[model samples]
Target: MKISCSISFEQGLGERLMFFKRRIEKKTYDKSSKKPVIKSSICNGEQVAGFKDIATGAFEEIMLIKNQDDLVEFKEIYGISEEIEKIY
Candidate 1:
């Protein structure tokens, strides 16, 4: 007897896998010197969620804010509760 199994990537399985991967992965930044911010592009209106250095005014890109879900995920991963300032 022989048995064979095949998995198709056409379905939404890939997205689920990516979601799980993101959920499992955790990251942290310096809260004392860094604050949550959303950097927006003036020309294209692109938004990027990240942490900004309070003293240096430097931004570290974390993820793209495509929708509300992405923003929620970003906040959850970073444990941010307060409002995030937007910069252009």
Candidate 2:
């Protein structure tokens, strides 16, 4: 099954990694200073895929929805409690 998630960040890559480290309960590191720095990964039970960009530092996962209502249904099913300010 294809699934998508959106993530937003207020700081740079370093801060974003820290956020995900806490949210997904995973290990993260600060390597933003390196050239061609590695960013986060989006994955399912099978494998890692891709991620979405939010702002300068923020990011959101992008998934293909069957319809407009599908997006709403996903939000409900996942129990996304935060208020998501959508852009386009």
Of the candidates shown, which would achieve the greatest lDDT relative to the real structure? 1
Question: Model 1: how large is the Cα RMSD against the reference?
Answer: 4.9
Clash count, candidate 1: 0
Task: State each model's CA lDDT, in order.
Answer: 0.85, 0.37
Q: What TM-score does candidate 1 reach?
A: 0.71
Model 2 scores a C-alpha lDDT of: 0.37
The TM-score between candidate 2 and the true structure equals 0.26
TM-score for each predicted model, relative to the true structure:
0.71, 0.26
Q: What lDDT is reached at residue 32 by model 2?
A: 46
Angstrom error at residue 51, model 2: 9.1
lDDT of 2 by residue, 1-88 (tens): 9999977665765554234522322222223421111123344222111132323544334344555554554445444434444332
Candidate 1 residue-wise lDDT, 1-88, digit = tens: 9999865445464552232334435567889999999999999999999988999998999899999989988888877888889999
